[model samples]
Target: MSEVREYIAHARSVVIKIGSSALTDLADGLDKARLDRLADAIEARMRAGSDVIVVSSGAIGAGIAPLGLKKRPTDLATKQAAASVGQLALAHAWGTSFARYDRTVGQVLLTADDISNRAHHANAQRTLDRLRSLGAVAVVNENDTVATNEIRFGDNDRLAALVAHLAGADALVLLSDVDGLYDGDPRKVSETGERARFIPEVSGPEDLDGVIAGSGGALGTGGMASKLAAARLSADAGVPVLLASAEQAGQALADASVGTVFAARPERLSARKFWVRHAADARGQIVLDDGAVAAVSRRRRSLLAAGVVGVEGRFSDGDVVELVDTTGRIHARGVVAFDSDDISSMMGAHSEELPADLARPVIHADDLVPL
Candidate 1:
C-alpha cells in the first residue's frame, strides 16, 4: 500500500475541493453541520503550515430553499439568479465556520474568462497566492452568476484541477458524496448482491476504461466521471489527487488513503504549458496538411504560413489558435503571430517571398503546445 500519511506529511501546498452535495442538504440547503465538519478539518490542516486553497461548490444548491425553488433550475438565467443570491449564503457559512477556529476565509469567485484569458489567469494566480501568504484560507468558486453556458466550466472538478495547477499545489482532494471510483456503479447491486469493487488507485488513462461514471447530483453538476477527469488533469500537471467522500475529509486532507488516488506525472509541466493545456481558450483554428502536422507533432517545429492550407475564425494577432490537420484533428494550440487577415493572405506563400515583418513563423515553436 502507498504511504498516504507520509505524502501529506511532506506536502507544502494542498487543495481541498468540497462539492455542492457535500455542503448542502437537498431539502434544507447549506448544511451547516457538514460545512462545519469540513471547515474544522481544513482549518486543522491549514494551521499545520501547509498552504490550503479550497474550491467549494454549493451556491446553487444553497439558493434553492431561499428562492423557494422546487429543484435546481435548468435554465441559465434562473441558475444565475440562484447563484447571485446563494453565493452570499455559501460564503457566510464558510466564513463563519472558519471564524470559529480563529482563521479568516476569503471568497474569490471566478468566471471562465478569469482562467482562459492570459492576463486574467495570472491575476487570479497572484490573488490566490497572496491570500495564502496572509494565512487566510482562500475559498474559490465559479462565478456562475455572470458566466454563459458556452464558456462556463461545467463542473467545479475541472475548476479545482486548474486551480491546483495555478496555485502550485502539491496535492488535490476532491470531497464528494461518493467515496471513490469503482469497477461498477456502486449504487447497482451485482448479481451476487455485492457492492461494486473499489478502485484504490488509477495509474493512468487505461485504468479508467471499464469505469462507468454516473450523472451529476440534483444539487451539483459534477459526477464521478468529472472527478476522474479532474484527477487526471491535475495528475498531468504533477499534482496527485484524492477522490473521497466528504465524510472522509479529515482523513483525505491528512493524506490518508481513504478513497481513490490518482498518481501525479513523473515531471511537472511549466505554468505556461499548464495554462495552454487546460485553461487557454482557442479563438480559431489553422488547418494544416499532413506535412505540417508531422512538422509540429514529430519535429517540434514552428508553424509557418507555407504549411498552412486554411484558417478558421477571425482573430487578431496574439490570440490563441489551434493547429489542426486535414482530418480536423487538433495537433497543437499556440498564439498566432499574425492577424487573421494577414495570415489569410500569407497562407501557402513561401517564407522568403512574404514581407520582412510577416516572414516570422505564424506560430513559433515556443508558443505552440502539441496536444
Candidate 2:
C-alpha cells in the first residue's frame, strides 16, 4: 500500500478520468460546482509540478436537460444529438472552472479512429504532448457527436485507459460516483445485512475472482466492471491506477489512502507496441501456417508471404491486421504491407519466387506485435 502511494506521489504525468455520473445531474445538465471542484484538484496537481490530462465523460448527460429529454438517450441518433448539444456546455464549464486558477484548458475530442489509425494516433500524441509542453491542461473526451455506433468507444473508461498510454502518463486516476471497488456491490446489503468488503488494492486478475460489478448508473455508460477493466489496462501498460469517488478527487490526487490502487505491472511494453496489441482495430486477418506462427510469435521474425495460407477482409495496405494460425488463434498483429487481394494472390509464394514488386516482407517485424 505504501509502495502504491509512493508511486502515485512521484508520478510526473497523470491522466484523471471523471465519469459522467460524477460530472452531471440527470435533472440538471452539466454540474458546474462539481466541475469547479475537480478543476481545483487538477490545478493543485499541476501547481505541484505534475502534468495532468483529464479524460472526462459527460457530454451526453449534460445534453439531456437542454434537449428536453427526460432520461438518457438510448438510440444512437438521440445520443449523438445530446452529445452535440452537451459538448459545448461541457467544454465551457471546464474552461470556466480552470480559468479560476489562471489555468488554460484545451479541449481535445477524439473518435476511435484517432487511436486505431497509426497516423492519427501519432498526431493525437503530438497534439497532447504539445498541449502539456505549453503548460495547458488537456481536457479530452470522445468525439461523441461525429462518432457513429460502429466507431464509438462505448465507454470513456476504456478511452481513458488508452489515453493514458497515448499521453505517456505515469499514473491514471478514475473518479466516479462510487468510492472504490468492493467484493460485492457496495450499495446493496448482504442477506445478513453485512456491508460489502472494500478492496483497497488489486495486484492482478486473481484478486478479482469473486468481485461483482453492478450495472451502470442511470446517467452513465460505464459501471464498476468497465472501471476495473480500464484499471487493469493502464496498470498492465506500466501506469498505476487509482479508483476513487469524484468527491475524493483532492485526497486521491494527494496520494492519500482514499481509493483502490492498482499496482503497475513490472514488465512494460513500448507505447507503440502496447498500442498495436490493444488499441489498434484489426481491419483484417492473415491466416498463417504453423511454421509462420513459430517464426513470428516464437522467433519474433517478420511475416513472409510464403507462410500465409489465407487472407480475410478487405483491408488496404498499411492497415492493421491480425496474423492468425490455421485454427484461428491470433499469434500477432501488424500493419500489412499489401492489400488483402494482393496478399491473397501472393500466398504460399516464396519471396525470391515472387515478382520484384511483391518480394518484400508481408509484415515487417518492426510493425508486428506478438500477442
- State the lDDT of candidate 1 residue by residue for 1-371, as single tens digits: 58543575458899889999998866898899999999888887877778999999999999988999989999999999999889999999999998898888899999889998989998999999999999899999999999999889889999999999989998888999998889878888988888788988888888887777777878889998799889999999999888899999887776556888888888998988777767888889999988889999889999999999999999999888988998888888888889899999999998899999899999999888887
- Where is the poorest 10-residue window by lDDT in model 1? 1-10
Query: Which regions of candidate 1 deviate over 4 angstroms?
Result: 1-5, 190-195
How well does model 2 score by local distance difference test?
0.91
For residues 73-128, what per-residue lDDT tens digits would candidate 2 score against the true structure? 99989999999999999999998998887888899999999998878999999999
Total residue pair clashes for candidate 2: 0
Candidate 1: RMSD over Cα atoms? 1.7
Alpha-carbon deviation at 166 in model 1, angstroms: 1.2
Compared with the true structure, all predictions reach lDDT values of: 0.88, 0.91
TM-score attained by model 2: 0.91
